[model samples]
Target: MTNHSHPSTTTTHSFKDLISMRQAVQSLFLAISLFMGIMFYLFVAQLESGAMPTLERPPGVEAFLPISALISLKYFLFTGVFNTVHPSALVIFLIVCTTALVVRKGFCSWVCPIGLMSDGLAKIHSWLFKRPVHLPTWVDLPLRAIKYTIAGFFVWSVFFKMPLAAVEQFIQSPYNTFADIKMLDFFTNISTTSLCVISVLIILSIIVKNFWCRYLCPYGALLGVISFFSLGKIKRDKNNCIKCGKCETMCPGRISIMENETINSLECSACLRCVDVCPAPNAIGFSLVSGKVPMDQRKIALVIIAAFLTGITTAKATGHWQNGTRIQAYQEHVLQDRMSSQPPMKIPANTDPEKMKRMIERMRQKKN
Candidate 1:
């Protein structure tokens, strides 16, 4: 990431760096996101076709519905009921927030699909320019506030403005219940305005290092604030004594690593690229409080994945992972919007014969 060019020795990566391992983890999660998108599309297709979905809806798709997650989070706090309408949304939100507390926005570098895309855009930025185009402190500092302002607006509106009753009502509202399908439709049937906006963001990301994450993402802004209290951080060993500017030039956060023993900037995503590029051994690492125990990209990736798996597994065990929206409700909502002619609601495929018989008879009785 350092823009300064030097005649350098080829660096051989050791287990201590493990940058590839971190990427593999990102790719794994990214692939999982794609799979969930496909499954959810098929599940919705079955519903619209008036057939039973042999494949269950992937609740992991709820990860994209963060506002619903925020509302559900407040509802759970107020009522102590983990509402079923968008249960997985709340579960995913809590899991991600927990990672910021433990590892300082590792979720951005290690898990989020956007983060992976951001990294690619950064490389493109490097290729397009001879040296990194950095904004001056006077301008950069003010721009950073934009995301915080955006995140603050949401926090204030949802957490402070909405009352307990309003929170409960939103969770049960038809909009919240059917949000996942609406999300699918948004992408599958994208409008011109949305497409143009997305293209602009991608282009900006390519021009500037992680433009969305650095200056515009509300989630990244919130995580950055939480990262101030993170348990692990980049710790530098000054006594090891190579004051090379490589680490600073390589830093995506644009932080000055040599000035301090610990890197406390909210912009640090725990990507560990600094550690990977450093020539001096034992000079810097992601270490815990005493600045002795090292956490490589591999170890942190495991911790991030473990945190997600544990949270999701516990949610499933408690019967709060899958949503409770009835299949009939989904049929009615999807077809109402998508189809012109109504088809007879059919028994879901691959169900017990007796159950299908009763459901068909029940539909017949309702029609008559």
Candidate 2:
């Protein structure tokens, strides 16, 4: 005779037991923090040389819309860095559309280095305060609306049938030139106003959890919208209900996962804390409806499509795409030339404008 029994399961988990859950969330946060550090170093290296990489130029480049980068790349490519009012700046304006679409707003939780830093601050706050801070819904909800208003103003101002020539002139100006710098010496020497704005944002992050992403980040608003269509979602199994309240307590975003099987796609980070902390097995999970999403297999394809359409549309409508190609080609040529004699050429502020203009004009003429 053989005796067999199912594995005994605990009905409850202590707060200490949730260490694994915390670590899981922290792990994602740490990975992003490391990535941001590397990016900061790379950006500094590029800044010293005065050359910005394609990645560096675009803020939130990997996000679905990446309007900041798109608009900036467009401006840089079309009119050169001397123009102050280039059409490429309109890329940040696409939040209106991104928000109305898929609600993945993963930009805040997943992509933005600054956003990640803000999250790290929140973690620190939890450690120091030893309690979660809760703002009234009336206060928190309305404050959240400010980002869109800022975004709306930005869009209306940039796209209000402005003269293309005027736009090109603005982007080429010195203020716009250093706006994309890494170490931001541009603030010290050229534009204190831009520097002050950046400084204030950094300080604000220390006091408020995701203050930048939640209220100020136009990119977050955009991704928050794209998240709506994301196939992978956090779901709860209501049938296995104990109403333990652990998931609600543990959620960083303060979402009540116990009540709804489907966490609002806009807020969930896919952090899996809800899943990991659940005393009941299979109560919460990341899943595809009907079939699994091929996000991994299809990522490259999606990126290509996103890049192509965003590029072409921004180009035809705003004429920034042509400029980006020209700038990139010139950069590649410069890098190759530097490799021949010295280290990778750090672009200098004193770079030959005539040479750059000639190169860019030729590319533009050919493309036309």
Candidate 3:
């Protein structure tokens, strides 16, 4: 089954080095996420102050608006129109899904913020416990189904249930246009319930490797399903196999690497850690199913990263990278959502008239 005919020996990276490359890629994306968050926050803050924003809104912030993207995707399919409400959201969603079709769940391992966090927590689990924890099979099977269940609901609701009219209305709604702001608000002003749930998830992830990615993330579930048709997978060679269980243990997906000739599990992210830990030079490696040419470890990150770069470049060139929503509209929506319900502060009669006038003027300026 191993089609990796005489894999190249010149590559200097071991499994450890491969892991380092993965971390570097993860860090790069994480930094991009943070920068976008900060810039987006600043832009929103200016809008809230009823002032024109000094910074241009980072369209990448729309990446957090996945539901909006799903609606836009549907709307586009029926009407042949790419709505300007949140163009980058759809662009980002398309890029991510395309990567799944091309590289399995590599996005989860190399680029997901959650994946980066989980890796850190997994190390903590290692330090805190002497033995690796494994969930009982009977209990584990149902637990892992939760993500697919959640993903299925969204897929059915958007694709099968929502009509084109409703999809278009949603795309044009204030909720969709301002969703990126709301997403920021979800973090900046999180509800008690959301905080509690997040904390619980973190604690659980410490106890269980990748609790969210493995069993709770609808996004990951969607990617995993699409990845079934992915071009690249970890194909194993039976003849070159050493029976050592290192690959299985190193796998973040917790796949039984030795049992199968190819790592075809939805859980496999094609992180290539399995290739790194294999002690034998040609014992095992990632081989594309279409042909015998094995994918080099160094090129895996390049492939995924290049896919993103190419997609984003193309989107920008095609005028779909940014939304056409006006800044004035964002300002109007922000006040309508955030401040219209707020009552004016009652001025005490004891206060001076000039001070009262100043306060009232400030409020008027903010409302404007």
Candidate 4:
């Protein structure tokens, strides 16, 4: 038997350093998201205050409108036209899905703000429990299916149940166009029920590592399903058979790395925790193909970043990154009482005067 005790000389950085690098990447994305949120709040506040927004609305804020994006996606597929109502929402959605196909749901691990929160809660869990809490396989297996079921329901509703015309109508609806603002209100003006639900989730996260990601996040479920076809995967070496179980212990996905030569599990986020914990040389690593040498963690990180940046750059160049919704429309929507039974028609601010006049007339007719 080959002695796999010697650490592979593939990368000079230690496992701890690799983990630090990942955390740093996660922090950078989280900071960007926070900045976007602040900018959006200022933009909305200006609108509500009846002042011209000094700061332009950050199109990146539309990333929160995933349901709108899904509707836009279906409409696009059916009509061969991209919806400008929230183009960035669809653009961000596509970027996320593309990353999953290329990097195995790395978005959940490296980019999502929610993932960062979950990681922080997991640390609290570790401090509280000392040893990691492991749910029994019987219970765990069924719970893991919940996210998939949720994802499936959305996909089916949008793709199978709704007709093409309905999809287009939904994409063009006032609700879809203003979903980002609604999402912001959801957090800024959270109700008691929402607060209680969030509190419970936070508590559960402290007790169970990645409770939301493992069982509830429909977005993660969609990505996980797409990641089944990811080019890269965690591969284990059986020949260098020193299975000390460190890899399994460290895996957030709770996957048994030693049991399989190739990890094709949907739950595997390709977070590299298993690779970081493996002590034996060439015993476990991420590979683009079966039986190939594993790529360095630094290289994998670069690839993931490059993929996202490239997608964003392409979207920007193609004029699909920003919605055409004008500042005026947002201002009107903000100032008006949206809770009224008859909300005003949401026309994009950039529409021609004649078109706007006709649309307003049609809305008036419908109301009367």
Best by lDDT: 3
Report how far residue 114 has shifted in candidate 3, in Å.
0.9
**lDDT per residue (tens digit) for residues 1-368 in model 3:** 43344242235677678778889999999999999999999999999887889999999988888888888888888888989889999999999999888778889999989899999999999998888787898988899999999999988999999988888888888878788988998999999999999999999999988988988999999999999998787766778777888888888888988898766798988788777777766766665655365676567788889988998899899999889999889988887877664887687879999988898899889856
Best by TM-score: 3
Ranking by lDDT: 3, 1, 4, 2
- Across 1-368, the per-residue lDDT of candidate 1 in tens digits comes to 11111111123565344657877999999999999999999999898777878989999999999999998888888778899998999999999999998789898989999999998899899999999987788988888899999999998999999998888888888888999988999999899999999999999888878888888899988888898898878877777639988889888788889998778999888888787787876677776554544576666887899999999999999999999999888988876877544566675677799987898799879855
Worst 10-residue stretch by lDDT in candidate 2? 1-10
Relative to the unseen true structure, what is the Cα RMSD of model 1? 8.1
C-alpha RMSD of each candidate structure in angstroms = 8.1, 12.0, 3.4, 7.4
What is the full ranking by TM-score, best candidate first?
3, 4, 1, 2
Q: lDDT tens string, model 4, 1-368?
A: 12232223245677789778888888988898999999999888888777788988899898888888898888888788887899888888998898787678888988888998999999999889978887898998899899999999999999999998788778767788788888999999899999999999999999999999999999999999999998778777788649899888888988877898778988888778777767666677776654343566666678778876887888899988888888877876775645463666686778899987898799879845
**Per-residue lDDT value at 45 in model 2:** 55
Which regions of candidate 3 are displaced past 4 Å?
Answer: 1-11, 341-368
- The C-alpha stretches of model 4 lying farther than 4 A from their native spots are 1-9, 291-293, 338-368
| Number of clashes recorded per candidate | 3, 35, 1, 0
| CA error at residue 334 for candidate 3, angstroms | 1.7
TM-scores of all predicted structures: 0.87, 0.53, 0.91, 0.88
Candidate 1 clashes between residue pairs 3 or more apart in a chain or in different chains: 2-249, 2-250, 52-348
> Lowest lDDT 10-mer window, candidate 4?
1-10
